[model samples]
Target: MVQTFLPHPPGARLALEDATRARTGSPVQMGLDELGTPLSQTTFVVVDLETTGGSPTSSEITEIGAVKVRGGEVLGEFQTLVDPGSPVPPMITVLTGITDAMLVGAPRIGEVLPAFLEFAQLGAGTVLVAHNAPFDVGFLRAAADRMSLPWPRVQVVDTVKLARRVVTRDEAPNNKLGTLAALFGATVTPDHRALHDARATVDVLHALLARMGPLGVTHLEDLVTASDPVPHQRRRKSHLAEHLPGGPGVYQFLGPRREVLYVGTAVDIRRRVRSYFTAAEKRRRIGEMVDLAEEVRAVPCTTALEASVRELRLIAEHDPPYNRRSRRPERRPWVRLTDEAFPRLTIVRQVTPDDDAIGPFSSRRAAEECVEAIQEAFALRRCTPRLPRLARAGASACVLAEIGRCGAPCTGAQDVPSYAVVAGAVRACLREDAEPVVAAVHARIATLAVQERFEEAAVQRDRLRSFLVAARRTQRLRPLWRCPELVAARRAADGGWELVLARYGRLAGTCLVPRGVDPMPAVEALVATGEVVAAPTTAMGAASSEETELLADWIEDPATRLVRWDESDTPLACPVRGAARHAVPARG
Candidate 1:
């Protein structure tokens, strides 16, 4: 999610800067107070594309509109509607005032792409401006990628970001292009159309440039490069204020030898400053940051734009371990099979987003092929959640458990091995045969009644029936499909063996294998080897009889390519799967 923070209004910043300049004969800390910003005197084009409707998938682009500004003046413009090659909705036509008739004689996207590209790159290099550049850019990128057309690396600027820095949060809380233009005292024309918005964007930009003063910032790069402010304030005497004035920007608290101790911010100047300097105030988050503070300093902005920029910059610059700690900490659930010895193959959560828990296979392949590992390993009900209270081990569990169908928790003796099996089974049922899982509730109740545990069993029996009634309406039995196995199958950057897969095989009817184990450690055996074919079936050299001995060759191999990226070539991502996207790879 590309979140946006409103920048101080340029007008407000300009007002403050003007006041400062009037008093000190120099620019004080204003957003556009120039240090170095990319400058271009060439024509700048602010563009927008209105789709047939809002959705990118169902709706298609209906109009492309733009306005050109050059040498602080308005140039020629472009606006056209292309037949979306689909049925247009009435609501869309009503909103955009663009009817099917209007687009019937219009050009197609193929012709439109080249035209826009030509207009954007009129001369040698051109600047493309968009209020929300990424949204427009995403479309352009997707369209280009789809058409296999190369998009020129033209300079681009996102006015939304610019406005955030230029406007104070309160001044322009709403940073919509139309809202911004109106805030700038520009005419508020009817909006939601492509061309009007672009024209208004140009007007707003011109007003900002005029207020910002001469830099010949024609392109978006110039505006951005220019946005970086210069610090020219008189150096502070030791005792006074060494920190940045209470302004909205990023802050860094440096420790001895410039080590970063803590990084944080305060919305209020005196409060944030007090949090650092005052003994009582310096206890919690601020206290921690202040304790390590050798130097306290900051950049000032009228809005959170500077704050966000500085925060991200400091995080990248310092690379503080504590700062980037994962919110979703690494903690995998394990079924220990307490019955087994030290090297018990535990079933852990599948790190992948697939439904692969259905296994107690001879191999990962068998689980992927069999698709019952989830049920066998977890003992999850075929399709329904376990009944309440029944989940807690007790006498009820004993009655059901006595029948051999369940690993009961009710009585003193719970089947430890069966518990492990059922746990994996439950996971599998949920993953694959969801509806059948609910159907198994009857099976649970039936087992409970065999021991004359009628009361306890009957209550469960009723709940299971209700559950089944509810579940059948919602979860239909879908085809049991196997999730793709996209394991990276890593080898260590340094040589070593990882006993990732404890062992894959079966005991009794319940085939048991360690599900959701990290394959990286096991692949450590593969080392730097690029292609790993299954180990050759060879006569035992006596040493080969031992798993340790079997791992010797891989343990010894160093120059082998241990791991490869599962998808595109990138370093292995760890914490492999969780509630978040794009996790950092786990350290050994």
Candidate 2:
């Protein structure tokens, strides 16, 4: 017969008694809690656990301590020191004061858990309480697992979390057991015993919960808890890595099949998927996202660009509940610079081949330098064309031309040469290729270093940065993982589309574009160049016209992908089905 300090009692009248029964009857569940809503027979089975070590997976429970509190009063308790079937570590011995010697003749967890669980069920609907419920809950689950038992669906309360909200995140002097005990005035005297810790946790919960008025800490059933609080620092209970696939894809979270909660992307699908579970609270954004999710699903793409295009496509296609930004096609700005006799900087709403003004500079200083560059290169006048009548025409060169900014363009001195200089600078600014600019800047900075002109060298550094910014404007916007030029077009046969590869210039190979992979749903042609710009279709009911899958086939090959943007010189790298260059008819 099972030995016990008290007689077994009948189940309570509340419905939640079923929950308590469920936990204990499941053979070996993590722990037991009183069931029932707060308004109906609200009470608590406050519990705590002392373990041989911090880890539940590797460590065993040395003791299980519990007590029942009803109507704001302690009803009864059952505390036991269990033989973990392993030697207690020295550190645990020092802290918990439980040793191999103390547990030599004690009942093993298997021998005593039934009686413990039975007593807990007697007060079913008792809200399980612990400083950090996960710690208690984890060991309980571990104990159940040791006996090949399933974890029960029992509720819990975490005083540690309660203190975070009930009191304040940072106001507490300490959240530790002793500190909390002191805060709640529950500590009779500090001691490191299992009963002492359990009792202290109860005190902390009692004090903290009482103070949580209007902050919603009243009801026991409504509070979230776990029998195990200090679970392992891992995503899965067993600490195994969440396996994921390595490919381009879009991922989604599901709460039952009806609710599509979150959507995300990854080039290496597995790494991205696994991150949701492994990310820590320190990564607030990701953690918050994961918390809202239940299950994950991914759709594979052959290439990163394909993944990207498909990712955007699916967001608009499905409109997953968790995505915050707009999924429809919209316009974003691009920086451009203009060419002039004395290059002037200006912003443009759009970029086309005919435009060569000064700057599409997102950075203001970069635009100013574009003006300075024109003046320095072509010796052009920086002064207004319409100057005051009071000043003589030949008195002095314009601001720039006068100060050797140009070869005196104000008085028409070296007008041809000055204009030529301006032309060179404008040309340099317009060149999207940055290698030349970086080389020149490096040479110039090196020259300044030789001259010991550190300040000038600093200016050169800034200038170089400006050059790089202009150079990388488009490059940075486009992910490097996408392959070269891929053309998704209407196929001649079945009215569907096929994505074709253009190696350098000519269409040579093709692949079937998968459904729902285009990021830009609308097909757009760059106004001046007649080249397709992947944009969402603005027309009503238009399937994303641009082919998103054309390049997926050739992305892995070295010889297929090429650059084809007619007006842009931005060297792009794509896997295969993207822009590629091939030899063409020589221009006149």
Candidate 3:
């Protein structure tokens, strides 16, 4: 009776009696059955080659042996010896037993290669297998290139790699074919001859396939990648990715309790999700999450922008433990001029329409650094306490005034009107122009460097960088926030137009206009049915700062074109020159 293996979890019955089925057949089913050929129906040509030397570039193939098998039944065999066009080395003759006398009457590789290629490529679904495939295939490819013949494209599997993955050291001493053939009790032992080794590899291949059956590698596609160093536990979960769409989308890993464990975006959902179970996924935390994951859900999108926006929204909503970035958009900090008499810079979590804010900085420390840069550039007051409308009689000035860092309006030395000049420069630096502030900071840094106070100059330089980065981010996002509605389009990767509608700096809706279709109707339909975003109460508008930043990046891409702008007063332009122009020159 022929033994049949059913796809099952670990510890389940590994074999069953099935006399009617093929020897290596299995009642296998997988989620990607439609896309992948079943292993039971796959045709594998186990091949071996004996060469004159180790390196293909310096060597010539002496002998070629291949056995074509399907479902554990031998279909045909190919065996040939090729003259090396040179005398055989004594060492090679000793190792492979192919002496000069044996090769004298054999055909040249150019003649034998064509017949071997024809036999190996029986038709579609033919895969080339060998004990050490790279060594054998490399020789064949080099010979074909030297002979000016087109090498046929075929999937090659190395039994040496497969043995390393399936046969543990305890089961076999090493991954060499001789050891593996002995361990698997192959009828044909792998001698130094090519045909003998090729026959032995066939038996080892079937044994390894049986071992992979319980690991859910029933499809030829899965079997091809089975040699990867991914753990069997993770490999078992690859079926979860088989049903994902092969397009741009967001994917969520759901735990056993159905709670989302992680969320991510990818251009090809199936390919990206499948990578998580392969050796390519190096993140330890994500591996842990995958181990506990029970299901994968996909949210297909028309374009990459839609996919990324959805990923951010899902991360914010679920607060998945595995996602460390963009999880708490509410906690992002902003630098705003306080609505006080002095109008000092303050780091705030929220903003108001009337507030003159420059950021939604990445962190409180970053916002503080930007405030320091602005305060250093201008004589803005550093004191946190609010000053009275009129200075009290006998009020003492703070130390900032002595250091020339403040205007000292508290002691009445500089009245509100005089202090207003410094505040005006600050407001200009934050909102309309940064050149004056950047120039002032650059001058200070240059002076400090001339004095050889390099450490202080470096500190000043860092502060200036923080300020410029925050300025650029705020400037880029500010115009979008003020605009009530905007429509933009970019050429999609699929030769379509990706139309996006933004309302108050938030992505209201997006759609893809298929290639050769009129995009105007899609744009009109998108705008008409998009979310009706209310006027923003803050500089960040209806969306989180991170979301606005993402939109800003997409809009600034060279491929994106502005189709419509609803608010004429708020022209989509950054009044301030970009920070790149004022980059502080490095000191000698």
Whole-model Cα lDDT of every candidate shown, in order:
0.45, 0.50, 0.82
After best superposition, candidate 1 residue 287: deviation in angstroms? Answer: 19
Distance from true position, residue 19, model 3, in Å? 44
Off by over 4 Å in 3: 1-38, 41-45, 67-78, 105-128, 141-156, 447-456, 493-495, 576-588
lDDT of 2 by residue, 34-57 (tens): 112442246667777788888888
lDDT of 3 at 424: 78
Worst 10 residues of 3 by lDDT: 1-10
Candidate 3's TM-score reads 0.86
- Model 3, position 195, has a per-residue lDDT of 94
* lDDT digits (tens) for residues 276-330 of candidate 3: 8877888899999999999887776667777788789779978999999988887
Q: Give the higher-lDDT candidate: 2 or 3.
A: 3
The top-ranked prediction according to lDDT is 3
Ranked by lDDT, the better of candidates 1 and 2 is: 2
Count of backbone collisions in candidate 3: 0
lDDT accuracy of residue 571 in candidate 1? 22
Tell me the TM-score of each prediction against the true structure: 0.34, 0.41, 0.86
TM-score, cand. 2: 0.41
